[model samples]
Target: MKVAIIHDWLVSYGGAEKVLEEQLALFPQADIYTLLHKLGSQSPLIESKQIRTSGLQRLPIGDHRKLIALMPYAAEQFDLTSYDLVLSNTFAIVHGVISTPDQLHMAYVNRTMRYAWDTYHQDLAAFGVGGGIKRLAASLGYHYLRLWDLAAFQRPDLVLANSPFSAQRLQKYYHREAQILFAPVDTEQFAPAETRDDYYVTVGRLVPLKGIDLMVKAFTTSGRRLIVIGDGPQLDELRAMAGPNIEFTGKLSSPQVAEILSRARGYLAMAEEDFGIANVEALASGTPVIAWGQGGVRHTVQHGKNGWLFAKRSSESLNAAVEQFERLDWLSPQLIAQSAQQFSGAAYRASLRQQINSALQRREQEN
Candidate 1:
């Protein structure tokens, strides 16, 4: 089949990009289409693809964030008429692409653009740019984006979700039901170590939604050590708020991240993630997680079994959970790693093939 993969942007490597990478692995012949492509910004495997970017790429501005307003237009402008199948890996606007009646368009939606819906104001405030005329412009832009986002859902033949949590969001926000497909976890790449380090670890973009501040606060009050890996907008702010026991490693190589996860006392996850891949990585390392009790972690983590889930999203709740975590028995690393193996790349490839076959069969029947 002549397949084309649509992604929102290729400016950075992230969870959605990771999913896109897996999709590329499944359909090596598929051409990649994105709103913007910053060369050398992602994995060499993705960089090796026949990547095609939209007009957004030509913008003189280095920041992709400023181009959000033009994304819907850019997304719709991608020409996919020649392709037999169009697979979209959407976190933002890529799902809005115009598809022909003859093509089967399948979407793997990680998030339904929470900024345009659930966390609209919070995002504005977090970015510290939503004031006066800027706020008014953002509000109007997101409003239009919302309208376009709703219409975009109608183009896809089938929609798949990265997690059950994402499926729920797809239903709630887009008014569309999506089949659940867990994101691929490189279980083989993250193996358990015989011994663990004394400190807790958390790996991800240091952003407001990640609740890094909450983790830092909780760990600070408890006087337990925390090692935070990764960098983002809130890095400096989080670093300022963190106490002596907390350490920031900025960003590290994949092997370094794996080694830290393998040796850490437990992985601390504070985000209401679509699917906490880092949690799976931790489990693969035979480490448990202390996660906020919401989103995809509810499915990945078995409370009091594989990991502990705080009842609330606050630091107090997380602190209490930490206190309780100190009293729990150490889980078997082999068993924890075994559980995470179910989300391995092999499983994703099989499930993706099944979904594709089913989608193709459905299209044939319709014709």
Candidate 2:
């Protein structure tokens, strides 16, 4: 079968990119299509593939990260009829691709568009598109994108949601049902450490939405030490504002992150994540997590078992949770490592292949 994979962009490697890699492994002959492709700036897995891009590639903005802003307009360009099977790993625009009856379009969604509406207005406002005008533009953009996002749901023969929270959102926002498949976690690469070091660890982009600020505040106020991994727009200002107990370790190699996760006393996740890959990584490292009870963290972290979930998404709630962590016995390394196996790469691949096969069989029967 001629399989075609679609993704929003190839600017940076993250959880979505990891899902794309797994799809490629399942269908080695697949062709990849995207709205934008940054030649040397993707995961090694993506860089190794032959990728095709949309007309947006012609724009100067395509060479830089700013092209993400053009995605609402960029999505209208895809035509998927040429492929026999279409698998879209979409966090944004690739879902807008049009498909034929003969072609099966399966979408693996990370989350609904975060920047276009209710989620990240403050981040969008920073672009200098002020007040009423920004709100008006964003409103119109959300209307158009919502139509586009819902339309993709119709094209897809099946949808795979990365988390239960995402599955619920797909039903709520798009009014579409989806199968739940947690994103893969490479347990082999992130093995449990023999002994943990004293500091706490947190990983992910340094963005306002990520709520790293909450973790920094909670850890600092409670006199706990923390090492933060990853970087973003909020990095500099956050570093300046953070107390001495918190250390910001910009972006690091995967091995470096694994090493840090291995030795940490516990992982601190403050974001309202769609599904947290780092949370699993911490569990694989035999480190329990103290995470805010929101979004996918509810699905991934089992409170007081594998990790503790903060009842609220605030510094006080997180601080109180950390205090509670101090009271409980650190979970056995063997049990923590065992919990990580639930999200292993092998399990993800098997479940995805099974779903794809089922979708294909149903499509054939319909024909």
Best by lDDT: 1
Worst 10 residues of 1 by lDDT: 12-21
lDDT of 2 by residue, 1-367 (tens): 8889998888877778877877888888889988888788777778988998888888866355456556756666676678888888888877767777777888898877766544656656655566697678766766776676677666677888999999888888778899999999888888777777789999988877778888877777887899999988898888877889889889899899999998888998887788988899889888898888888988878888889987788989988888898899866977888888988888999998889889889877877
**Candidate 1 lDDT over residue span 1-367, tens digit each:** 8999998888877777777878888899999999888899898899988899999888899999888888888888888999998999988888889998888899988777888898888888878864799888888888998998999997898999989999888888888989999988878889888887799999999878899999988888888999999999888888888899999998888899999988888889889888988889899889999998888999889898889987789889988887898898966888888889888878888998999999889878878
Off by over 4 Å in 2: 62-73, 117-130
Best by TM-score: 1
Candidate 2 lDDT score at position 51: 91
Would you estimate the TM-scores of all the predictions? 0.96, 0.93
The TM-score that candidate 1 achieves is 0.96
